[model samples]
Target: AQSVAQPEDQVNVAEGNPLTVKCTYSVSGNPYLFWYVQYPNRGLQFLLKYITGDNLIKGSYGFEAEFNKSQTSFHLKKPSALVSDSALYFCAVRDLTDKLIFGTGTRLQVFP
Candidate 1:
């Protein structure tokens, strides 16, 4: 079975500092990993994806993630944070049917 787990329910960060949100997955085949963000009253917006090659992948809004095959982890990171970056973050895995199974959703509160 394929699944993605985000153990944290929330993460707090001050503006202009580095930030990260943890993610890990299990899949039967090569996984297609994805990150997305949601603002109040809005649907999720795609941040990035890792299909193949390059364990380290960069994404939108100055975010990036390292895909670790051995550890079965894909942790998101950002060099510096912004207050506007505050939102609900989700880590998902592409299922066999091309559907996404999302985490419960992590609330990222970026204090100014």
Candidate 2:
């Protein structure tokens, strides 16, 4: 079974500083990793994904992730943080059955 883990329960960053949400995945074959962000009382919003090709993939809201095969990790990153960016972030990977397996999720808090 494919699984994803978010080692951090929460990440704190000042508004205007860079922020990162860690994610590591375990899969049988080629990994299909994804990142999503959920605001308060909102559904998960698509952030980015790594299917193949480029190691670095950019997504909505100035977010990007690097696919590191050697490390088996795909960490989400943003150059600058914002108070509005405070939300719950999730890391996921596709299972052999083509279903998404998500991590426990990491809450991001950006302080001013």
Give each model's clash number: 0, 0
User: Candidate 2 regions off by >4 Å?
Assistant: none
Model 1 stretches with alpha carbons more than 4 Å out? none
Alpha-carbon lDDT, every model: 0.93, 0.95
The model with the greatest lDDT is 2
Give the per-residue lDDT of model 2 (tens digit) for 14-100: 999999899999999999999999999999998998999999999999999988999999999999999999999999998999889
The superposed Cα distance between candidate 1 and the true structure at residue 48, in angstroms, equals: 0.2
Candidate 1 colliding pairs: none
lDDT of 1 at 16: 87
Worst 10 residues of 2 by lDDT: 92-101
Q: Candidate 2 at residue 82, lDDT?
A: 92
